[model samples]
Structure formats: structure tokens, C-alpha cells
Target: MTGSPAIPEASAASALVFVGPMAAGKTSIGRRVARELGWEFHDTDARIVAGHGPITEIFAEHGEAHFRALEEEAVRSALTGGAGRIVSLGGGAVLSSATRQLLRGFPVVLLTTTQEAVLSRTNLDKRPLLKDDPEAWGRIYAERLPLYREVADQTWASERRPKEHIAAEITAWFRANHAPAEPIHGEAKDEQHD
Candidate 1:
């Protein structure tokens, strides 16, 4: 055991993952948390968009199943990188059983907001699923609540509060609970200054 490399006390899935309905501010809040923690940040939806195209076009041309497949791959790539960071999943990412399974053992947070809040918060025209049927988001949220709760280690309401506050609270919880005794890989970047 002499001169052996130090083993990580935490798992590869130790990164904090954010999940919830659309317009729940997961990306913004997760970015803030990453900045505060000095860790990397990845938004799975953005990954998908970058690799393929706009989500609306993907849904229209290839359909939901195809898009979900791409989304699953994005989730996998983000979490399996063996780094402690913040990852914001697509709103419908939890609907994939593979994604849900991969989320196990990871620090997952669910950001919940009312349908009214979501409607008033963002543009629906860009949301493919909600463009023609904005009310469908409520039903989708209801249907997915159980899955969200299943993977979420904690839940935070994004309603009537600044995203910075939510990110700070989540970051505090992460520091108190899941912060490694030391850095798992290397020094976390000072993302705030960058």
C-alpha cells in the first residue's frame, strides 16, 4: 500500500444533478451553484441542442423517442466524466428509465414551480411540447412528479424566489453533506471569476 495513489472517497456519480419541469430555472440555478462551488457545469438540454439541433426541430423531425435517446446519451456523458460538477437535465429526461437508473447514487435536486409560474416566466413558442398545448405542461408535471421524487435527494421550490438564493441554499447543502474530504480529481476551477 505504500506509494499508492489516493482513492476517491466519493463515487463517479457524485456530481449534483438538477431535474424538474421546463422553465423551472434549473440551468440558471445549477450554473450559479457551480460557480459558487468552483466546479464545472453542464446542461444536458444544451448538449443535445449542440449535437443535433433545436429541440423543437428534433421533436418535429425525429419525434420524442429519438430526442429522448439523444438526451439519455447526454445525461450519461455528463455524469460519467468522473468530476464533481453541476448538471442540469432536460425537463423530460427523467422519463427515461435508463436516465433514472443512472441518476441513482448521484446528488439529485428537484426544482419545482407551479404551472402558472412557468407560463408567466418564459416564452412558450420555443417549447415544442407546450407551444400548441401550454396546459400540457401541468399534466406532464403531474405525471412525472413520482419519478422526480424518486431520484431527487432534495426538492426546492423555484416559485417566488430568486434563483441565486436557491442555488446558494443548494450549494450549502452540498457542502455540508456531499463535499468530498478533498478534491476527487484536481483543483476545481474558480468559475466565478472566469
Candidate 2:
């Protein structure tokens, strides 16, 4: 029997990538989804921290540009890694055009939260950008919203919902839309025609 076209083995169809502003629960929710799906989970921010050091230290000592470069490297690594993964990107990871271009090959999900929700969930001490001015979160999110939209294949509003429920929704959507392709049964190479 004939079968539909096969997806590239290394394409984004093999992974679910989450992107959004700080406190949007990308890491937490992504972990849950990956666990439920029995897939690997990759958090680019965590990769940066493990490889370099704390992000705050990176910003304080090296500055945002340096941190962004490191972030892009981490993003590239996660996206290019073999599939069956849920990858969570830092809020600012989308700022790089190169990173955004890399994301175009994958299934990207945007997790969003209201200002009130984010303010309530945020630990300003850890966020270098919002440490001195928490209100800056609004302005920053506004500026980056377009970029987030540009890369996202699906937008999930994560405000005021239990992470389990949100993860379930994403999981269901992923399974439904990105189910593995069936093997082709037609045209066996070894068959001898009469």
C-alpha cells in the first residue's frame, strides 16, 4: 500500500519546543509533557547554567550579549540533537535571528501569561532584566511578543491553569498532530516482477 510522505528524521516534527516569557512555565510544563510522552526533555537555560554558570552571573560579569551568544549555542545544540524531545527555551532565546531560523524547522509552542499571573509567579531576584524594575517585564514581553508569535506553531495561554492540565492539552495536541508515520508497504525492492 502507498503511504504519505515521510517527515525528515531530524526535523522539528520529532520534537516539541516551548518558548515564552519568564514565568510562563515552559520548563515545568515541558518536563511534564516529556515525561508523559516518554521523551527526553531539554531546557536550554539549564544547559547554559550547567555549561557556563548561573545566568545572573553571566549577565553581571559578561553582559547580555555574551549571555545571548551562549544561549544561542545552547539552543542550536538542543534543536539539532536527535528527536523525541521536549525542549524549553529561555524567554530571550528568540531574540536571535539565527536561533529563530533554527526553530523554523521544529514544532514551536508559545506559552503565555498575563502580567498579573507572571508578576505573581516571578522571582525577580533571579531575573536580571526585572531585578531592578519588575514592571519592565511588561515592556519586555510586549517587545518580544511579536518574535514569539513569529516562531510559534501553536500558542498556549498558561495563566491560571494547573500545569498538569496545560501539559495534557499540549500532549494531546502533539500526539494528534504529529503522530509517527506508518511504514511503507508498497514496492518491495527484492520482489521479482513477471
Best prediction by TM-score: 1
What's model 1's overall lDDT? 0.84
User: Which ranges of candidate 1 are over 4 A from the true structure?
Assistant: 1-13, 184-194
Q: Which pairs of residues collide in candidate 1? A: none
**Model 2 quality (TM-score):** 0.87
lDDT of all predictions, in order shown? 0.84, 0.82
Report RMSD (Å) for each prediction in the order shown.
Answer: 6.2, 10.9
TM-score of each: 0.89, 0.87
Best by lDDT: 1
Clashing pairs in 2: 12-106
Which regions of candidate 2 deviate over 4 angstroms? 1-10, 182-194
lDDT of 2 by residue, 1-194 (tens): 01313334457576789999999999889988887777778889888888888999999999999999899888877766665777899999999887887777677899999889888878899999999999999999999999999999898899978999999999898888874463212221111112
Worst 10 residues of 2 by lDDT: 184-193
Please give the lDDT score for candidate 2. 0.82
